[model samples]
Target chain A: MNVNQVVQSIREKVAEGISEVYFVACGGSLVDMYPSKYFLDSEAKKLVAGLYTANEFVHALPKRLGAQSVVIVCSHGGNTPESVAAAQTAKEHGAHTIGLTHNKEAALLNYSDYSFLYEWGDDSNVKNNPMAIILDLAVQLLHVVEGYAHVEAFQKGLESINGIINQGKKQVAPRARVFADKYRNEELYYILTSGASYGHAYGFAICSLMEMQWLNAAAIHSGEYFHGPFEVTDKETPFILMMNEGRTRALDERAQTFLNQYAEKVEVIDAKELGIGTIADEVVEFFNPVLFYSIICVYREALAEVRNHPLETRRYMGKVAY
Target chain B: MNVNQVVQSIREKVAEGISEVYFVACGGSLVDMYPSKYFLDSEAKKLVAGLYTANEFVHALPKRLGAQSVVIVCSHGGNTPESVAAAQTAKEHGAHTIGLTHNKEAALLNYSDYSFLYEWGDDSNVKNNPMAIILDLAVQLLHVVEGYAHVEAFQKGLESINGIINQGKKQVAPRARVFADKYRNEELYYILTSGASYGHAYGFAICSLMEMQWLNAAAIHSGEYFHGPFEVTDKETPFILMMNEGRTRALDERAQTFLNQYAEKVEVIDAKELGIGTIADEVVEFFNPVLFYSIICVYREALAEVRNHPLETRRYMGKVAY
Candidate 1:
């Protein structure tokens, strides 16, 4: 997987003129693109970016996605029907489409104008992680349009991603073990976070917990928790809080304070406590989600082990005709 | 409330070359702004629109939110600390701030550049509904910016909202009662929808079920459900589907077909069956969410009654110090 070549090809499209960028994918892929979407929205100088589930993208066919649009489709298997269809739709709308997958022969590659095949892995290794690749692509696009300096810091942070993941695994093991044991019998759990880590909270809740383990879980943004979800808190209620080193840390701190007062079973996965600060000071906010994802992956595995549910176990996901 | 006057004041601000619009609120109020946010993004020709939870809005402080920004803040009680702080922050950033609330004497009014007070009630009557008011305001801004014809169709539909509400109530009651009876003892539920009605599913699950009724529920977008949440469905799992007459109807239909094959406890609230078509044909997509909200409100009431709970009963929301 030549990332530079992929970035160069996307840069050429940007040179031609792309007024907007759409990150289109399904499920885990959609979740993978979210951090990139947030990064592009905040960093891109001239391009407007939006995130959409592949099916909805095909249905709504956003008015802004036209000749000057750049659509990025992501699928680990590269054969997700909705994603392939979304790429086809983007082409029909005269948008430049790019597909990112681990399988070169996947169906999504057939429709994308440009396709990049990377490596997929088990729970341990972090190389060529889909989320990291998407984030890097987003930053590279901004680097092409905006400037190299603005993204230089992020690029530097990306260099240490493998180390960060290893560190996260080490730091999260004990906590994950404790949490898995403590809440083994709990039928439902709420995962809470804010800002850059919100996407991880959402993705982990739905993909890892609900889909993979068939556990009942909901992810609530810390900022929105006080609004209504706080009502669910009680002396025995269980919550997992992902505290990131970002602008919205105060929101998570606020939630932590409240949860501490009411809930006895509260698990906190603070990026700072996990030594995220040692990676890079300036770009820590952008990397917090990546760290959180790495940690939660370990947490998921631990929970799966304790609950006697394999992470790959699924009743209906790809086995059925849905 | 004089909606026309509110329109007039916002129109004058639009004439001053508004660059962006921020719909800032929290909880149910945040959910109320989603349809408006969608409308603004799709309809506002020259203006950019973004939705942010109140705390996140203040924390992120988007670079685009300056003198040319129009920030609309909503708080049912008009005293929500985060919302009030968001409005104050918007004002400090030189953006034109508007606050919508049920109490004129509330603290939000003090920081808002303009304020509108409307009647609030128990979940039955749709008259002056918070979501409706916000949608109307968003359409009014679009009307001011890009001629009147596109919005006139929506305005016409708005006039018949009360009738639509009445129709929805009658149509959903029997199904709501049946669903409430069948799922009364279920420990958790999954609510699914797409497009405009997505917000209703989200709001109903959080505000009505989690907050008011103290039930566990998660809202999943129909388009995204197949990606991950489909794994949770079985012969015994309970799900509430909001099928709307909109562009995303096919997505919901697809989910319905899948759920029907696997889940025995699927309760669907279809807007087409609710007579949303007879009232207005041209803008039924825009009215679909309002219709769904109304129907779900009745469903929530039915569920509350069957579960021996009251809608206004809160364990911590307004009673806690968080």
Candidate 2:
């Protein structure tokens, strides 16, 4: 993929004075865009970023989404009805729309001004991760809009992501096996994280556990955990805390301390502990979600193996007419 | 509470050139601010509003939050530590800070440039609802900044909130009792809603069910429900559907159809069924959450009574040191 070509196209639109960027998608794809949205909010000086569920985007029809807006819609199969509708709605409102998906022939492409396709197969591989693609788009936009200084570091981190995933796979396999064996019969679990990792926690809980494995789960941000969620914690309550190297580390640490004091079935995945292959300190926070995602994939595989359930096992997703 | 006085105070700040509005809070208060934040995003022509968890706001302080910013912090007790810290941080950054709480002597007041107290007791009254207060602030800010035209309709709805709540309570009581009796032993539930009602579903699931009653629940937005959450639903899944009068009603209707076909334990509270007390149709969506909250309070009471679990039962919060 030519990153510069994509960046230059967005730059032309930015030069025309865009006010905001909207990342619209559904489910895992929506979760995939959150870290990118976070980066845009944190780094962009000229444009603001908003994350919206595709169906809600069509119904809510944000007032700011007009000629001076950029909307990016993501769907792995590109056939998600709400996502296609959102892209069409955004285009109808005169906003520049971009579609990112693995299916080149997806209907979403027909409505988008620009469409990019990544390679994916029946096997779930990390090479075509939507999160990485969205993050690249966000960095490029920020680079052109605000002369973002950390583009080089971001690229370097992206290049090292595969190596980080490989290392994480090796380190997490045994731990994941143990955890899966211990909690395979558990009915519900809570995944906790803060900052960029929160997105991964949410995606894993809903997409991997709830959807794929048919388990019950909820993802709570550490910053909001003490407020009400902490009341649900007990000695046997299962929780997985993704502690990443970010500004919100203290918030996670505070929650971890309390959880450790009470919950016996607590699992911690610290990004610093699972090294990210010699990435720069300044960019670690920006890349924490990527690292967490890689680690979580390995954990998911181990859990699937132990529970005798394949990661692709789904009872209602594509089976019923919901 | 004089809404006009509050509006005038916020207007003076608007005249001073505010750039963005930050809604900062934790858990229930944070959920309460979501609808107001949505209104600010949708209606405020010249201003942007960002929602942040209190601790995250203090740590990842947005670059836009200096000098020309307005930060609104909400805490029912007026003594939440993270909320107090967030107010102080915003004030230190030269942002105009406002604190909304029910306690006048709460420490958050010391760090706020302006503070408003409401009367909230064990009765769960709508008069002092934080959501109503925050919505008023958002509308007033838009009124002064962008000459918003919906201020009158919004105020009319606010004036009729108590009546709406009373009518909703009366209609929801027997149904709530029946549903509670049916599912009091259920371990987990999924509350689904869309658009404006999404915030109330989330707040009720977390605050009233998870925190107050120590129940396992997850609130999924109808827009994103089909993406993954639908896979977790079966013939016996306990789910609550909040069907309110709004643009997103179609979204909720779709989900209700699916749930009714598949899930046996489905309880729906349709706001349109229980009227909003003569409010204008244009502004009814804005008041749906308030009506849902009132109905849910009665549902909580009914559930609490059936299970012999009082609303105030606490195991961890405010009981033991973290």
Interface RMSD per candidate: 1.7, 1.3
Model 1 misplacement above 4 A = A1-17, A43-46, A122-127, A146-149, A279-282, B1-16, B43-46, B122-127, B146-149, B279-282
Task: Point to the candidate with the largest lDDT.
Answer: 2
Candidate 1 residue lDDT tens string, B1-322: 3656765766676556666678999989999888887766554445567788999888877665777777899998899998999999999988888899998789999998877786666553454777887787777766665654566667777877778778668877887898899889987788999987787788988898889888888899999998888888888888999897868899999999998898899998888887777645445677788888777888889999999999899978778688
* Residue-level lDDT tens digits of model 2 in A113-221: 8877865532444435778878888888777766778889888888887677677778988999898888888878899998877878889888989888888888889
- Tens digits of lDDT, candidate 1, A1-322: 3556766766676556656678999888888888887765554445567788998888777766777777899999998989999999999988888889888789998888877777666553454777877777777766665554556667667777678778778877898898898888887789999877788888988899989888888889999998778887887777899997867889999999999889998999998887777655555677888888778888889999999999999888777677
Per-prediction DockQ comes to: 0.64, 0.71
DockQ versus reference, model 2: 0.71
Which pairs in model 1 have colliding backbones? none
lDDT string for model 2 (B1-322, tens) is: 3655755765675556666889999999999888888887666656788899999888777766777788999998999999999999999988888899988899999998887787674465575678888888888877766777777888888888888778778888889999899998987888899887787787887889889988888888887888887888888789999997877888899999998888899999888888863777666777888888878888889999999999999998899986
Q: In model 2, how large is the Cα lDDT of residue A250? A: 92
